[model samples]
Target: MSQHTLLIEVGTEELPPKALKSLSQAFSQSIVNSLTAQGLDVGAVTSFAAPRRLAVSIAKVPSATPLNEVEMWGPPAHIAFDKDGEPTKAGIAFAQKNGVDINALSVANDGKIDKVFVQIKQGGDAVAALLAPIVEQALAELPIPKRMRWGAKRVEFVRPVHWLVMLHGDQIVDGQVMGLQSGRNSRGHRFHCNEAVPIATADNYAAALEAAYVLADYDARQQRIVSQVEACANQLGGIAQMAPSLLDEVTALVEWPVALAGKFESRFLAVPAEALISSMGEHQKYFHLTDTNGALLPYFITVANLESKDPAQVIDGNERVIRPRLSDAAFFFETDKKVSLESQRERLKNIVFQAKLGTIFDKTERVAKLAKSIAERVNGNAEKAERAGILCKSDLVTNMVGEFDTMQGIAGYYYALNDGEDNEVAQALNEQYLPRFAGDQLPQTQTGTLLALADRLDTLVGIFGIGQQPTGSKDPFALRRASLGVLRLLVEKQLPLDLRELLEAAIAQHAALPAADGLTDTVLQYMLDRFRAWYEDAQIAPEIFMAVSAKDLSQPLDIDNRVKAVQAFAQLPEADALAAANKRVANILAKLDQQPSQGVNTALLKDDAERALAEAITQQKSTIAPLFANSHYTEVLSSLAGMQSTVDTFFDQVMVMADDIAVRNNRLALLAELRALFLDVADISLLVRAKA
Candidate 1:
């Protein structure tokens, strides 16, 4: 019953920062699953990650697993014994294979009749002995997207394994990984403190490493980096603008983080603040500083991997590396401005977006036409939309954009303004790529919103036209992102644009090819599937989307409104009962339709109950028809629910069929009308049933 703390660390040569967080999470989860599967009582598994190591500590872990018994099945009741009730060879063999005798077996009820079975007694094993191999197996199965082989056996891993620390309580749980053995020792601070540091237990891991000039806890290390960088910038009469993502990357890239301040030539600051900050953050992992007026300062702060004997030496080294990077950025920015924004439009003709499609220029032309068409339909300014579309892709040819690919759209706007282009045109150039990720900003200007939608729609139609649709995880062209972008624009902007017409016109612009290149119904279905996925992600009810989506999805905004109406209706008190009755009507009508029939004969009405149901439906249709035409789905479902009582009464009081064939046909026709009314809202049967 004794419990102990368990610690394991895998040391490696500097791992990619992007892979550290995920790798550590996977390592912790794998260890927890492995320990649980082995019947060990585990508690509080904590993980730590750095560029050189992945470590996990489990507190209050059981020292050994409890013994468990397993049941073994023998032959069937009748087959296990002969007519004289004697055991057969099959039963004896099963007992022997299970390490038991026939006399040890007994009959037990297995929720049916008594059956022949065996209960095997198992003994417990020490948890420490069991965890070594299990932990090794789990590490071997860890999912590291890309792995490499190093040294003699060339065992594969995300990076070459240099050492491993494994301990159970205060004892080393000895094991080997990739030709390296686990011990109580772990290396620290790659340069400043490279000697092996001994660890006693899981509780001592963080403090032990810290004493050796290493900070193993990622969050603590990141906090230190931020505070030091901010303090350094504050001393220079400015504040450091921290990038959370860049901070995370740098945090993972070092064990003993040392924040050092460095200065650059002030002339570099004259080359657009964005270009300067992008170079510093993107290329060097340095945090940029700005004065209170929001102007870039000449100083920046960076984290060093090691604490140097002379701190000034480290600062000078980082400055040397940053100077060339900033100089390259400045050159690209200044040379790019030499060409006017209007002149760059000509260069897009040579940039191929996709081989099957024409140049980037052709895409721009198509998007421009689609944008104007959309603007007119939405009552937006047509001139602004057209102008935005024309200049949106021009930035791809700019020198600064070529050097910093992430600044493609952004760099275009700055250069465009320098060339004296309209503010709207420059703004649209940047806004076209807005909302690149979920919850990111969308286009703020009307023209930019229109152009963004048009550009995405054109991409969806063109790629789908060529049959290069996204399948599973192989979305090479990011079509899924484009689809979500379109959905977000229409729904969030409350734009009154028709998605189906937009797709058709976008496809039509590229439709001068052979029949092999024509747009098929499959392409539109693919786009709708994307819409359904987006709707589900938004937490909307699936039945609502299924119901209204069956009618028309051309107008995405209208589809959204109808979905809201259906969701509200499904939550009503009478929704479930109405859906059940509607489903019954649907089933009966489906069976009747399968048989050949044209019209119902009124003379076949033989019972009062049947006659009453027929009259009720006719009157209800008169009231529901106008409501459906107005898209009052809530009112339509309400009236349909009111018919449930009459439907149930008719089913209970009268038989739908009579000896005469005409009578059955008339009854089926009446039920078909009831089904069609509910179908206008949704196939209500798909709605989830209410709990009693």
Candidate 2:
């Protein structure tokens, strides 16, 4: 068997830019996995993704597939032979079915049964012959949400398939893939070459395409874009603000990238930098430049697909195109200030928030009340928080926010400040929507935090109350994100507010929602589930989360502290022994047919070990109660560890179940109290790792 590099390329007409890289990776990995499963000794794989194509190159792939030995079992030997020790009908039929003579069959016996069997050895085929269908299969399994057909062809793909190339070193594999015949031909950059470029060998694929003005590798192209854009920005004594996603999208848009510097009117900078930057980066895919003081510059960088002979023309064309876009943004900003943000409150009444939850105005009224209530509990100014909540969604009606959807909360901040509202209230308009996605910043001001909490709570409770809970893989309202946002605010902000109290307060504001049992509990559980994932990402132990969550603490910050305290205590040498004792105590309490009395009887105390353990518990109980009250869980957990020796000695000396009914009940009561102490933080019984 000879080893060779295998190349498969599927050419299309401009694949979706955002999905190009991922789709290319999936296609490459799919082919490699399929070949590896077939016992092929394929080597390194390189994937190529450009605007017009997705390709993979595998090195040192064996020319011949490894043989497979298959075993076939037949009828019992007793049934295969006649009474005269001659061939029976069963023996002859089996030989014919296996395509062999009757005498070629053999018999084998196991401990209890005798049977006839045959071993078939299947040989491998050439790599070139095997890859056409493999390439075709990989294309069939691409992660395209929708596929298209071209020119009435029965075949379909992410885009119309134009060409297919399957090469084993210098040899072309012969077959059809996605309606295209196999060949060594691949077209170069759309404007650079416009003609078929022949690939002599699989190893020369990238070099051949590069000569024709294309970067075959996505990462290489992206790095080039970054380097060129930065160099261009530095030339103007400013730094470019190009987001990574923007760079990736730009790389996908061009094959022969040529970064050029262009300038728009400096007057456009009179608009907010965010609006100007949004117009440039989002709508035009241009990289914006910032001056020394971090102020927006008039110049922007654009990546052109071709290096124009008269580069000034390209730059002029880009500048001319951006003038109208900036003018529109300026118009929206200036016109929107004519109306106060407060004036839009009446407009919200006509906008439906949800069919079941009245209108936006009604929801805002509910959020305002909830925010004020929550503010009172957390030392926040109720009036400021309420005012912020009422005006939070008011920007949705403004002309500026309507045109630039990303500017909703931000526009409200500017509008509120213009309307001469309190500085805190103006800031809250923007802060209420902080931390829009994972790892985003949370609200910093007291007013902002309370309003954010109030807004999310109203939506979550109202949505879940109407039985529109998010099912698997479908959260249209982003309930999971809303839930996590609420948790993040509570835990990260160190707010001592009770989650249940907030949920119920928010629920009470919704008169349209039905009064039902478990409404608060359902929304609370849903929010708590988000923490499981959040903590998992932090690499906290699953058992630690289970132990803390089992305690059902209503305050997220308290639960957070307890879990940390428990984690710290588990690191102590005393943890395993105390955890085992707790497990034993739990088992004893679970087996009691009758509920034991809450307190141990002084007269019933019998063993010295039990007496010593009781005294130790009574002493530490005083110290930890105050610590627990202060939410100083770390100190409390450490204080409990001092009683470990007494606990271990009692479990070692006294059996929990005594023959006498009174003694057994009294002992059960003592164990129950011991378990309850630990249960204040977590069910430590769950902390013990089961023995093998």
Q: Point to the candidate with the largest lDDT.
A: 2
Q: Tens-digit lDDT track for model 1 on 540-627?
A: 7667677676675666666776777777787777777777777677666666637535445567767777777777778888998998
RMSDs, each prediction?
A: 3.8, 2.7
Candidate 2 C-alpha lDDT tens digits along 158-243: 88889888898899988888778999999998887988989999999999999998898988998899999999998998999988
TM-score of each: 0.88, 0.94
For model 1, what is the alpha-carbon lDDT of residue 66?
A: 71
Worst 10 residues of 1 by lDDT: 511-520
The pairs that clash in candidate 1 are: 499-554
Q: How far out, in Å, is residue 446 in model 2?
A: 1.8
lDDT value, residue 181 of candidate 1? 77
Deviating ranges (above 4 Å) for candidate 1: 77-89, 101-103, 107-115, 233-239, 263-267, 290-298, 511-520, 594-678, 688-692
